[model samples]
Target: MGQEINQTQFNEQAFKEYNRRLLNEAELLQTQLTKRCFSDIGEICGYELEFWLIDHNYFPSPINQAFLTRLNNPLVVPELSCFNAELNGVPLPLRGDVLTAISKELSQNWLQCQEAAHGMDSVLMMIGILPTVRQKDLCLSNMSDLKRYRALNEQVVTQRVGRPLRIRIQGRENLDINHPDVMMEAAATSFQIHLQSAQRDAVRYFNASIIAAGPLLAAAGNSPFLFDTDLWDETRVPLFEQSVEIVDEANLENHRVSFGQGYARESLFECFAHNIATHPVLLPMLMDTSPQQFEHLRLHNGTIWRWIRPLIGFDHDGTPHLRIEQRVLPSGPTIVDMMANATLYFGLVRFLAGLDDAPESRLSFDQARNNFYAAAREGLRAQMVWWNDSVTDAKTLFMEEILPMARQGLKDLKIDKADIDHYLGVIEMRVQSGQTGAVWQRAYREKHQADNLQLVAAYLEKQRSGAPVYEWEI
Candidate 1:
C-alpha cells in the first residue's frame, strides 16, 4: 500500500492485461525461489510506525497535508487518513547495539515530527486508536489526498457491490455500525516491525511470528476503546479485518484481510501462490519493470493485509531479498515500549526459528489463529493453547516459557547484555505488573467515567514524559 500507482482508472481490458502480467511475475518468482536465486541476507530489522494527528483539544485533526509539507522529510508519509501519518525506519543488521541504535533514530525522528506538527498548529500522537475520534471524524473527507487511497476506496466499495461496510464487535460493550468507505480503517494505527531473512529460513520465521502473535499482543495490547465503546484489548484486529471486508467469490469463507487459511508447508513462496490463486487484483496498474522485479506481484501482495505478511525486496546491489513483516503490535504508550515490543518479537521469533522441530508442526494453524484472536479480545488474561496441547494464560506462558526463550535468542544473536536486559526488562515488568497501554487506558476511563478527550490528554501528557507505559500512573 505504500507504493503509488500512476493510473487509477481501469477498464476490463486493462484489468485483464494487468492480471495476466501479475500471474506471469508470480510464476517467475516461483521459479527463482526454486532455483535459490534470492539474496542470502542475514537478519535485518526495520519498522514503520503509524500515528494520529490531533488538535490542541485532543480531537482528530485533518491537517496532514500542511503538516507533511512543513515536515518535508522523505521517511515520513501520509496514511489512509489525513489525520494519520507514518514514520519508517532504516533497516539495520540485528546484532549488538542495534536496538539502542534504532531507538535513538526513532526518538530523533519523532522529535522532528513533533516540531513539524507544532508548526502546523497540530500535535502528533502515537496510539492504536485515538479515544476522541468519533464516527463523524472518519468520513471520506478525512482521507488523505492520494490517488492510491481514492482508488483503494473505489475498488473495495465496488467489490462489496456498493453495500455499506458492516462492523459488529462484541466485547465488554458492543459496537455495530455501517460505514460507506474505507475510512473506517483509518481509525486504527499500528507500529509494524519488519525482519529480513534468507529464503531458506523465511517460512519458519513467518510461521513463528503467527504463533508468537498471541503472547506478544497480550503483552503490548493498546486500543481498548473505540468510539467510547469498550471493546477488545487490541480492537484494531477486528476493526481492520472488517473495515475493508471482501469475501472471495470462489471461497465465500476466505477474506482478504485475514490470519491466513493455513501455515506455509514448504516455502514462503507457498504464500505468494496462495495469494495469486485466491485474491482478486485490487490494484491493477501495470509497471514498466522486468519479470525479475516482480512489481505486479509485490503490488498484489500489498493489497492482502496479512497480520504476518511475506515481503520481497531488493538489496543495495539490486539483489532480491525476502522479509517477514510483523503487523500485530499497536503504536505507542512510549517509544521505549515500542522498542520493547520489537525486542521481544525479534528475540522470540529467532528462538522459535532455531528450534530442532518446527513449532507449527506441534501446534495446528487453527489453534494459532484462535489464540491470536483470543489474546486480542482478552489481553494478558487470555488463555492460549501452546505446544504439547497445554492451555495457559498469556502472562504465565510469557513468564515461564516465552521470556526465557527470548533471553537465550538475544544471547545467541550476540546482542549486548545491557541492551537485551534494558529492552526485555520492560516486557518483564509489563507482564509482572499487568499494566499495558490498554490496562492503563481502561483504568483511567473507569475513574473518569470514560471522558474520551480527557483520557487522550492524559495519554499525551504521559507520552511526552518519555516514560515506559508501566511507569506511568493511571
Candidate 2:
C-alpha cells in the first residue's frame, strides 16, 4: 500500500502545527545568527534593486519577462510582475569610497539591460507606481510565469476566500477603495535597496534602521500621486500593505490583518518572531526529497506584512549570507538619484551602528512609524519631532543634520570624493529645489491634466532623455 493525500486540503490543525514549527525554526535561526558576527562591519556589503520596464512611450512593457527568458542572465532575473525586472549588481566590499565602483557597475548593468531590451522596444523607468497601470492591466495574465509569484498569489487569494481587499487611507481626501482580487498590489512599484550583512547583528540593525529612517525617506516625496490622485507621496507604502492583507470579516474583534504589532526590542529576530507568531504561514513545504537531489514545491502563503523583508541566500561558495531588502522606496528619474538615496541609507546604517545609543530606545517605534506616514502625506513639508520635542521641518533635518552626518560617514570610509559629490550633490539639489521624483511626477501630471494616466506616463518618458531630474525645468 502507498500513502496518499488530497492535494487541496485546508486542514486548520495542520496550519496551526506549521505555525508552531516555524516559530521554533525562527528561534533556532536567530540563535545561529547570534553566533556569527563580522569583525569589520564596513568590510563586506552589496545591494540589489528591482524596477519595472516601460516602453519609450512610458507604458508598462511586456518585454521584461521576454528579455529575462531570452537573455537567461543571472544578473537579471524575472520578477513577480511581467513588467518588472531585477538588477543584480556586484557587491562592493566595505573599503575606502566604494560609491564610485557602485556607480560604475550600476551604470554598466543598466546599459547592458537596455541593450538587451532594445530589440523589444522597451526602456527602464522607475517610479513608485507606473502612472499608466490600469485596472485591466492588473490581471493575473500580466504576472510573470514564475513559481514563487504564483504560489504567493494563490495563498493570498485562497486565504482571503471571497472577501475583497479593502483599503481606507485618509490622505488629502479619504480613499475608500476595494479590489475584488489581490491584483491591486501591482500598483505598488518600488526601488528596492539591498544591504549586505552578517547573521549575528543583521536583523537587529535592519529593524532599527527601518524604524528610524523609513519615515524621513518616505516624506521626501520620492513618490507622490498614484492613479492621478494626489494621495500619499509614497502611496505604495499603504497600497502594498492593504493589497495582500488577509482578514476574516466575521471575526471583527480578532482581526488578523493589521499593521505591524510593535517595534523590535533588540534585533530582527524579534520582528521575524513576531511575524511567525501573528500570521499563519501562507506557504509551507512538505518535501520528501533533498536539495541538489530532489525538487520541492513550498507553499508560499501570503502575509499581511513586510515593508522590508530579511532574506537568506547562498553565495557562489554556498556560504549563507543575509541581506535586508528595502521594499518601501520609489524608483528614480536617474540612476544617480537612485544611488544618492542608497548612499544616504548606507551611510546612516553605519553611522547608527557606531553610535552608543540605539535609535529605537530614543525614538518610540510608534513615532517612527508615524513619521513615515506623515512624510507620505506631506512630503518635505513633513514636520519631524526631534530632540527637546522640537518640531523641525524634514528639509531642515536632512540638510542640516542627516546630510552632514552622511558626508562624514562616507568620508570616514575613504569613499571617492567624486562619487560622494556626484551622488550627494544630487540629494542636495533635490532638497534645495524641493524637486523629488514624486514632486517632478506631480508637476508633470498637472502640466498634462487633460491627458489620462497613460499619456502622463508617456510625457515623463519623453522628459527623461534630456537633463538630470534636478535640472529639469518645471
Candidate 3:
C-alpha cells in the first residue's frame, strides 16, 4: 500500500501549497545528491506483489475487507478493489542464500493468505489478471473502500475532462472497450522487485534495469487474456498503460504510467525534477511531517507508475537512500518462479551496472523501449536486439547469452553457489521449454478447446501444487 491520506478531497489552494512543498523537496533532494549526503548502504532486496481474491466459482471475489480483518497481517494490505490485495516482503541484505529466503517467506505469507480467505469460503490467487473477471466486476461498486483509491478515480476522470478511459488492444484477437473509472487498473496486477543501491551506483543501477527489462519480461509473461479476448502475451502491460490515462493537452510523452522518457545521465534526482516540471500531481495530500521525510514528494511520485521507477527511502538512522524498482514482471505462476525471476533480475543488473563500458552505452534507449513492447506482444519468441546490435529471438538470447551473464553476475555478488544454480537453472529450463505462464495458458486453451473458466480451474490446480511454470502441464 502507498501512503494514506487523511482526506480524499482538496481545494485549489491545497494544490498550490502542495506544489510548493513538492518543488522545495525536489530542490532539497537535488542538493543532497550534489553533496553526496545519501546513505552509503546498498544491495538490499525487497518486493511488493499484487494478488486476486476469488470465490469457488473461479471469479473475482469482493471480500478483501473482511478477509484482511481475519488475516491481520501488516505485510498484506488492500489494493485498488475489494477483489484484490497486495503483499510486501521485509527488506533484506542481498547475499548468501537470500533468494531461497525470499521463496520461503513469500510461500508462507501466501499460504496464510489462502487460509484466511478460505475461512470465508474464498481462495486467494496470484496472477497478472484473473481470466474469469468481467467488465461488470470492475465497476465503482467494487472499488476498495479507501480514500486514496476513490481520490485517484476522481482525479483521473477530472484530468481526462470526463472522457471515458479507452482500451483498444490488438493481438491474435482484437479488443476495444471503454471504462468509466480507473477501476480498469484493478484488472491487472504485478510483482514489483526493489533494489536498494549504494548512492555511488544509483544511476548505473537504474539504467541497467531499463536495459534488462525486455528480456526479463519475455521469460515472465503471465497475462494473455482479458474480457474473453486473446491479447498480448503480457496483456497487463498495455492494459495498465491505458487504464490510468490522463488527458495531456500539451501531448507530452508522460502518460502517468509508462516505460519513461530516457535513462538517467547524472543522478536519479533528474527523475524527481522531471516529475515536478512535467507530470501534474494526482494526489496532492498535504502532510505535516518534516520536510526531511520527503512526504509530499513521495506522495506525488507514487502516482506516476514508471516501468523502472527510482525510489527514495530512509534508513533506521533517518539517512535517505536511493532504490530502483523493477516493475516489468507479472505476479505469479508459483513462488519459486517469482524468485527465479528475481534471481535473473538481480544478476543481470549487477553485471550490467558493473560493466566498465555501460551496457546502456551500447544499447540505445529507443531500442530498449521498443524491445520491451515487442516482448510484451510476442513473449519468448519475440526477436530482441542484443548489446552487439544483432537480432535474435528472446529464447535464443536467453539460452546463448543472458543466462551465462546472469550466472556470472550472481557469482560476483557472492550469492551462495547452490542458490545461483537452483534459481538460474529454473530460468534456463523455463526459457528452453518455452513455457512461461502466458504460453501455458494459451496452450491449454488451444489444445483442449476449454472455456476461460476451465482454463483458470486447471491453472489454479497446477499452481496449488507449488511447481514452477516450466513443470506445469496443460
Candidate 4:
C-alpha cells in the first residue's frame, strides 16, 4: 500500500489484465518458494509508528501537509487523514543492543517531529485514538492530499455499492455511526512491527505470530476510549475492521481486513494463493515491470489488509526476502512502552517458532482468533485458552509463563542481558501492577469526572515526563 500508483482510472480490460498478471505472479512465487529462491536474511526487524497532530485545544488539527513539508524528512509521510502522520524506522538486524538502538532512533526522530509540529502551531501526539477526535472530524475533507488515499476511498465506496459504511461497536458503551467514505479509519493509529525471516523459517514464524496475538494484545492495550465513550480496551481493532469492511458475494465469510480464515496449512505460499483467489483486485493500475518484480501481485496483496501480512521485498542487491508484519499492537503511551511491546513480540515469536511441535497444532485456529478478540475486548481481565486446552487469565499467563518464555527466547538470540532485562522488566511491572495504558487512561477519567481535554492534557504531561505508563500517577 505504500507504493504510489501512476493511474487511478481503470477500465474493465485493465482489471482483467491486472488480475491475470497477479495470479501468474502468485504461481511464479510458489515456484520460487519451492526452488528456495529468496534472500537468506536472518531476523531483521523494523517498525512504522502512526501518530496524530493536534492544536492547542487538543482537537484534531489538519496540519500534517505543511508540517511534513517543513520537516522535509523522508522517514515521515502522510496518513489517511491530514491530521495523522507516520514515522518509519530504518530496518536493523534483531540482535544485541537492537532495542536500545530502536528507542534512540525513535526518540530522536520524535523530537524532530515535535519541533516541526510546534512550528505549525500543532503538537504531535502518540496514542491509539485521540480522545478529542469526534465523528465530525473524520470527514473526507480532512483526508490527506494523496492520490493513493483518494483511489482507495473511491474503490472501497464503490465496492459497497455506493452505500455509506456502517460501524457498530458494542463494549462498555455502544457506538453506532455511518460515514460516506473510509475516513473513519483515520481515527485509529497503530505501532506496526515487521520482522524479516529466511524462507525456511517464515512459515513457523508467521504461525507463531498468530498464536501470540492474544497474550501480546492483553499485555499492551491502549485504545480504551473513542468519541468520549469508553469502548473496548483496544477499540482500534473493531473500528479498523469496520472502516473498510467488504463482503464478497461469492464468499461471505472472508473480509478484506480480517484476522484471517485460518492458520497457514502447509507453507506461507498458501496465504498468497488465498489472497489471489479470494480477494478481488481493487487497484488495477498497470505497471511496466517484469514478472519477477511481482509489482501487480504485491500491490493487490497490499489492498487485502490481513493482521499478519506476508511481504515480499528485495535486499540492496535485489535479492527477494520474506517478512512477517505484526499489526495487532496500538501506538504509544510512551517510547519505553512501545519498545517493551516490540521486545515481548519478537522474543515470544522467536521462542514459539523453535518448538519441536508447533503451538498452532495444539491450539485450533478458531481458538486463537477468539482469544484475540476476547483480549481486545476485555484487556488483562480476559481469559484465554492456551496450549493443552487450559484456560487462564491473561495477567497470570504472562507473569508465570509468557515472560519467562520471552526471556529465554531473547537469551537464545544472544541479546545483551541488560537490554533484555530493561525491556522485559517494563512488561513485568506493567502486568504485575495491572496498570496498562488503558487502565491509566480509564483511571484518569474517573478521577477527573470524564473531562476529555483534561484527560488528554494529563496524558501529554505524563508522556513528556518520560515515564512508562505503569509508573505514572493518576
User: For this target, which candidate reaches the highest lDDT against the unseen true structure?
Assistant: 3
User: Candidate 4 on 1-474: residue-level lDDT in tens?
Assistant: 288887667789999998889888988999998899998888999999999999999999998889999999999999999999999999999999898899999999999999999988888888999999999999989998887888888888888899988888999999998889999999999999999998889989999999999899998889999888899999999999889877743554568888888888667888888887778888898889999998988898888888888899888799889999899999898999999999999999999998899889999988999889998999899999998899999999998889999998898778889989999999999999999889999999998786889999999989888899999998
Q: Per-residue alpha-carbon lDDT of model 3 for 363-469, expressed as tens digits?
A: 99999998999999999999999877899999999989899889888988899999999999999999999999999999999999999899989999998998999
Model 2 Cα shift for residue 63 (angstroms): 4.1
Candidate 1 has its poorest 10 consecutive residues by lDDT at: 246-255
What TM-score does each of the candidates earn? 0.98, 0.85, 0.99, 0.98
Per-residue error at 172 for model 2, in Å?
A: 3.2
C-alpha RMSD for every candidate: 1.3, 5.0, 1.0, 1.3
Question: What shift in Å separates residue 85 of candidate 2 from its native position after superposition?
Answer: 1.9
lDDT to native, each model: 0.91, 0.63, 0.92, 0.90
Of the candidates numbered 1 and 2, which has the greater lDDT value? 1
Q: Which stretches in model 1 have alpha-carbon errors above 4 Å? A: 248-253
Decoy 1 TM-score against native:
0.98
Candidate 3 residue 383 C-alpha distance from true site, Å = 0.8
How far is 459's C-alpha from truth in model 2 (Å)? 5.2
Q: After TM-score superposition, what is the CA distance of residue 313 in candidate 2 from its true location, in Å? A: 3.9
* Alpha carbon lDDT at 236, candidate 1: 93
Error of 4 at 130 (Å): 0.6
Per-residue lDDT over 1-474 for candidate 1, one digit per residue giving the tens place of the 0 to 100 score: 298987777889878998899889888888888899998887999999999999999998899888889889889999999899999999999999999899999999999999998887889899998999999999888988888888889999998899988888999899999999989999899999999998888888889999888888989999999999999999999999999887633553457788888888777888888888878888888889888899989988999999999999999999999998899999998999999999999999999999999999999999999999998999899999999899999999989998999999898888889989999999999999999999999998898875998899999999999899999887
Error of 4 at 360 (Å): 1.1
TM-score quality measure for candidate 3: 0.99
For model 4, the superposed segments whose C-alpha errors exceed 4 Å read 248-252
